[model samples]
Target: MPNITVQLLAGRDINQRRAFVKDVTDSAVLTLGARRGDVRIVFEEITPDTVANGGVLASEDDSRAEVVSRFVPQASS
Candidate 1:
């Protein structure tokens, strides 16, 4: 059995999470010789305010803006 844990900022769609879990399970089955039923994946979603970098909350840190930008889709102008 293989267990995997992933943590990310909140707001990802449920479909996206499901796809991630499926992909991880498939990888474990192929690369680790684990059965799909024996592979477990857990996702933890946290708010930006709960994460801190450089002693500053992610919600308040300007430096983290670029990093977070990658995870969030850009809105049309």
Candidate 2:
């Protein structure tokens, strides 16, 4: 059995996560000869406030603004 863990800031939709897991599972099956049932994948979501770069919190990091925008809630019109 192969176990995989992925960590990223939250905000991705179900479709994106589903596709990612499918592709990873396919690769494990093909490269490691692992059965579908034996493959495990875990996703860990961290918030911007919990992470920092260059001693600056991600939530306040100007350099990460573009990437962080993806996780920000969209305003309804």
TM-score of each: 0.75, 0.84
Cα RMSD, model 1: 4.3
Give stretches of model 1 more than 4 Å off. Answer: 66-77
- Which candidate ranks first by lDDT, i.e. highest? 2
lDDT of 2 by residue, 3-53 (tens): 999988899899999999999999999999999999999999988888999
lDDT of 1 by residue, 1-77 (tens): 89898989866789999898988898999999999999988888876677898889887788878766666544588
Q: Give the residue spans of candidate 2 off by over 4 A.
A: 74-77
Question: What's the residue-level lDDT of 7 in candidate 2?
Answer: 88
Candidate 1's TM-score reads 0.75
Q: CA lDDT of 6 in candidate 1?
A: 93
Model 1 error, position 69 (Å) = 7.4
Each candidate: RMSD to true structure?
A: 4.3, 2.9
**Worst lDDT window (10 residues) for model 1?**
66-75
